[model samples]
Target: MAGRWKNDLNWSDTTPKAAWLNRRQIMAGIGAAAFGGIAGPALAGLGAVKSDFSTVEEPNPLDHITSYCNYYEFGTGKEDPARNAHMLNTDGWQVEIDGLVDKPGTWTMDDILAGTTLEERIYRFRCVEAWSMVIPWVGFELSDLLARVGVQSGAKYVAFETALRPDEMPGVRSPVIDWPYVEGLRLDEAMNPLTILATGLYDEPIPNQNGAPIRLVVPWKYGFKSIKSIVRISLTDKEPPTSWNKTNGREYGFYSNVNPTVDHPRWSQASERVIGGGILAKRKPTLLFNGYGEQVADLYDGMDLAKFY
Candidate 1:
């Protein structure tokens, strides 16, 4: 299962693993010294096999990835998550699994990661705003998690919810687009091998601002489809409501797949500006499914993407 999918990117496309390991070791030592022999999770290194799903493009810098984000729980600004997410306490994070699963209950982070094998997937992350980045996400398949929970026969959709602590999250105080951000996926889409619950970035535990502990990563869809800081997962017979879609269905669709032919009501989705490419970076033409169409296009067979989108 190491290289199940076709490898579009060579090993040379990413930073050498040896260099990253050495850097992690140094960071761990510094953390141990600073916290009196207690290294933080951020200093801990995750051992993962490089995924075949990784893209060939060089990934965005860690700073750019972390600093520029869309965690609306923190704020609407791109830099707000980096500045305010620290206030969030994920020490005892637990995700509530309910609806149509056999094992419907609150599962701790430890329980979630217990039998999971993490993989390093460097994927093209396309935002609905027409910006994109190559990100290295470390996680296990969502299908594995679904198997552990035992999907019921009637389950048709998978719904997700982000944590909403108004005390810690300043943005939640304002009614931007509803408090607890929610998103959903069809059962088959949720079970796809490419769908994962990312727990790390660049081999280190994911920073708080970037959905620490765990987050959903659906590479073929728009970035918002991959909900962060997930707190609830529900298996339902009906299509679950999504925050963005509920806010403005005309602009954001439930499928939210990257389709170059479909322009966003306010902007063009035909091309995207690469984040961290600095000012004046040439926009590149957007690809269907953000270039993962070969793997996911069939999921929408016989249906009109424009209508569903």
Candidate 2:
């Protein structure tokens, strides 16, 4: 009769309700616009609706939707991507390659999909936005993908880029943030097993706004550091610039570990909202590196998490 694990999103009738209604309408319209031209009446008839709530999950969809995104470019609105993502064209997406790599080339969506079988991994996605989810994502190691491209010895860092279309993503046009978001990780970090370039979610193709085609998922880092709708991957010797750090240097660190003790400049990191909580779930304490320390804590051994955090 209620959410499996009640999230704590209490939409005060005035603020969240109005926000939700407006976003849904805009997102639906954008979806229609993107497909209506191609699929016409058929596409409109086949439009997507909100998913029936997941009963088998511990944290469930409420957590899944809110804690896993850098959708702010869609607007500071948490629901912006879902609303404005209809503007992204994931079907014909292409990932470009350049920089210090020996095998610099381009990859199409088909090329990437055919490269490996999707592996389902259940990971806790901690959003810097102060919400969280335990997602059963479908993807494989970024290391494997990079190996295929033959990373060179000079590759000290790897940079990623997302596609930008101001026409469809009205948020990009507003100057609320920069366009074509960028992110980077050290070469070793890039090779970590915990780093995933996700293609699907809940066993289905990722929704367009969820960085469809493919996106990075680094479990230990904050959500923004792991970018979406990637269109490029580069091997470089110099430290690459990242979106959040450049925009708000003091607040968004280059290495944004999931730490409950260290607070962000704007708020406390000790707790987070259980998104999609349908108005009853409690907010839970956040965890370090989103609880993958068993596998990744070693990556930062001897180094101070607080310093980078």
Which candidate has the top score in lDDT? 1
Which pairs clash in model 1?
none
Put down candidate 2 lDDT per residue, 158-229, tens digits, no spaces.
999888777656777676556678999999888877787888665557777677879898977887877888
For model 2, the stretches where C-alpha displacement exceeds 4 angstroms are 1-59, 62-70, 278-280
* Top model number, TM-score: 1
Residues 6-111 of candidate 1 have per-residue lDDT tens digits of: 6555656657644544565567668676878675654456877777777778887777789999998899999999999999999999999999999999999999
**Predictions: Cα RMSD each:** 3.3, 9.5
Taking all chains together, the TM-score of candidate 2 against the true structure is: 0.78
| TM-score of model number 1 | 0.90
| Candidate models: Cα lDDT each | 0.88, 0.71
